[model samples]
Target: MAATIGTETGAVLVNPAARNRAAAGLRSIVLPLGLALFVLVAWQTYVTVANIPSVILPSPISIAKYIVARYDILLIHAIPTTVESAVGFLLALALGVLLAILITYSEVAREALYPNLVFFQLIPKIALAPLFIIWLGIGSTSRIAFSVFIAFFPVVIATTAGFLSVDKGILRLCRSLTATEWQVFTSVRFPSALPHIFSGMKIAITLAIIGVIIGEFITAQAGLGYLIIFATARADTEVSMAAIVVLCICGLLLYGLVAVAEMIANRFYSADSR
Candidate 1:
C-alpha cells in the first residue's frame, strides 16, 4: 500500500512538468503560424479590394502561385546562397572564437584589437561591399569572405563577455586546487561561455544570410537575392515576393538547425556534468 501511494505521488509530481513542456512546444509552433496566416489573409484581401496593381504590390496568393510555377529555378538559386551563408557563418564562428580566446587570455591583444574592432564597427559595412567585389571579383569567394567579416564581431564580443563573466570565486577555488590554466579554462570557462556563444551564432546566422544576399544583389549572377533584383527590375513583383518567401524559408531552416545543435550540445553538457 505504501509503495502504491509513493508511485502515485511520483506521477503527480512528473505529469504536470511534462504537460507544461508539451504545451510550450505547441504554443511555439501554433502562435507563429496563426499570426502569419492572419497577416497573409489581410494582405490578400487588401490587395484584392483595393485593386492594387501587381507591379506595386503582388498579393500573397500571386506569390504562392509564382513559387509553385518556378520552384525549380528558385531551388537552384537557393543552393548557392545557402552554401555561402552556412560556410561563411561557420568560418566566422571559428575565427571569432579563436580571437576571443586570444583577447581574453592576453591583455595586450585586448587593448590592441578591441578599440580597432569598435572603430571598424563604426564604419559603414555596406560601403565595403563594392570593395569586396573589386577585390574578390563578384564571386562566391567574395560573398563568403564578406559574410565572415560581417558576422565575426558579434561572436567575439559575446564570447569574450561570457569568458569574463565566470565567477571569481570559482577561479580562486581552481587556483587553490592547483588546477592548470588549460584545465580550468576547458572545464569552466568554455562551458559557461556556451550560452553566449550560441547567442552570437544565432545573430551571426541571420547576418551571414544578409551578407550573401547583398553580395548576390551586386553580382547579379545567382541566388534568391539575384532573383529578387531581377524580378523587381522587370516589374514582376509576384516573382520577387516568391523569391523573398523562399529566402525567408531558407533562413529559418538555418536558424532552426542552429537551435537544434544548441539543444543537443546543452543536453550533452548537462549529461556530462551529471
Candidate 2:
C-alpha cells in the first residue's frame, strides 16, 4: 500500500515536470507561430467560403502573389519612406534630448516652454501636415519636418520625467562632494534617465513612421503610402495589401533597431555599475 502511494505521487510530480519542460520549449517560437498559422488559415477559409470579391478583400495568397510580382515597385517606393522616417527620427532624438536637458536645468525655460509643449501635444498634430507642406513645399523636406514635429514631444516628456525622478539624496551627496553640475548630470541623472529615454524613443520611432505616412498620404509622388493610395484607387486590394505589408515590415525593422539599441544601452549601464 505504501509502495502504491509513492508510485502515484511520483507519477503526479513527473507528469507536471514533463509538461513544464514541453511548455518551456514551445513558449518562445512554436506557440506564436502556431497561433499565427491558425489565424491565417481562418482568414483564408473565410474569404474562400464567403466568395469575397478580390477587389474588396483579397486573400492572403493573392496578396502574397501581388507582393512577389510587384516586389521591385514596392522597394522603389519604400526607399524614400525609409529615408524620411530615419532622418526625422534622428532629428527628433537630438532635438528632444537637447530640449529636455534645457527644460530640466532651467526653471524659467520649464515654466515658459513645458505648458506650451503640452498644449501642442494635446492638439491634433496630423492636421498640421498640410500646413507643413504650405510652409516647406511638397517635398521630402516637408515630410521629414512634419515627422520630426510629431515625434519630438514624447521624448521630451519622458526625459523630463526621468530627470525629475533622480533621487534627491544623490544630488545632495554630489553637491556635498563639490561635484560640478555637469559631473552630477552625467554620472547620475543621465544614466538613471536612460531607460525612460529609451521608452520614449520607442514611442517616437513609431510616431515618426506614422508622421511620414501621413505626409505621404497628403502629398507624395512616391513611397509605400503613395503605393497604397495608388493601389486602392485602382481597386487593386491585393496590391494595396502588399504595400501595407511592406510598410509594416519597414516599421517593424525601425522599431527593432531602437529595441536593439535599448538592449545595448541597458547592458552598457549594467556593466558600468559593476
Candidate 3:
C-alpha cells in the first residue's frame, strides 16, 4: 500500500509516526487474541487427552457449544445486567462529574465532601449490596443504585485532577485576557479534562458491571450472574462458563464503546487531548 502513492521511485511517502501507530494498534489487539487462542487450545487438548470431566473444567469448545445452544436464554439474562450497568454508569458519570466540578471549583465542597468520598471509596461496597436490596427491594432499582455507588468515585477523582492539571500561568493568561468563567471553562477546562474523564469512565464501566452482577448474585432473580450461580449450584460447568464468556464479551463491547468515545472526544478537542 505504501508503494501506491507519493514517491517518484514508485513508492509512497509514508509517515513513520502513522505507520508506528498502526503497528502498535495491531499488536495491541493481536497479541492478547493470540495468547487467549493458544491458552484455549492448550486447555481443550489437555482436557480431552486427560479425559477430564466437564463438571470439573469444561473445555472452551464445550463452553462455546453451550453458548450456541442456549444463546436465547443467555441473551435474555444478559440484557437486564447490561441495561442496569449502563443506566447506573450514566447516572454515575453525570453525578460524578458534577460533583467533581464542584469540588474542583469550590473549596467548601472540597473540604466537606472529598474526605467523605475517600471514606466511601475505601469501604467494602460488596458488603453493602444487601443493604441496597433492603432499601430498594429485590429489583433493578437496587442493582442500578448499587452500581452507581460503586462507579462514582473514580470519575470524580480523575476529573478533579484533570481540571486542576492545567498550568496556573494558562489560567492567569485567560484572566488577563478578560475571559469570563464560562468562557475559560468551555474553551480550556472541559477540553483539557476530557482524557482523564474518559480514563475514569473506562474504569467505572467495569466496576458498574461488577456492581450489577453482585446485586444479581444476591437477588438471584435474573442476569448472567444469576445464571452462573444457578448453573454452578446444579454442577453445570458448561453453562456457567458460557455465561461468563458472554459477560466478558458484553463488557468488552461496552469498554470499546467508551474507548471510541474517547477517540472522538480527543479528535474534536485535538488541541487539548494531551
Pairs with steric clashes in candidate 1: none
The number of residue pairs in model 1 that clash at the backbone is 0
Q: Judging by lDDT, tell me the better candidate of 1 and 3.
A: 1
lDDT of 1 by residue, 1-274 (tens): 9999887678668897886788799999999999999999999999999999999998988888889998999999999999999999999999999999999999999999999988998988978987899999878999999999999989999999989998899999999999999998999899988999999999999999999999999995889999889989999888888999999999999999999999988986644652
* Candidate that would win on TM-score: 2
> In model 3, which range of ten residues has the least summed lDDT?
4-13
Tens digits of per-residue lDDT for model 3, 57-89: 999888888889889999999999898989999
lDDT of 2 by residue, 1-274 (tens): 9999887688678797876677689897888999999999999999999999999888998889888987999999999999899999999999999999999999999999999999999999988999999999999999999999999999999999989899999999999999999999999999999998999999999999999999999889999888888889989888889989999999999999999998888887744562
Alpha-carbon lDDT, every model: 0.91, 0.92, 0.90
TM, every model? 0.87, 0.90, 0.88
* Total clashing pairs for each candidate: 0, 0, 0
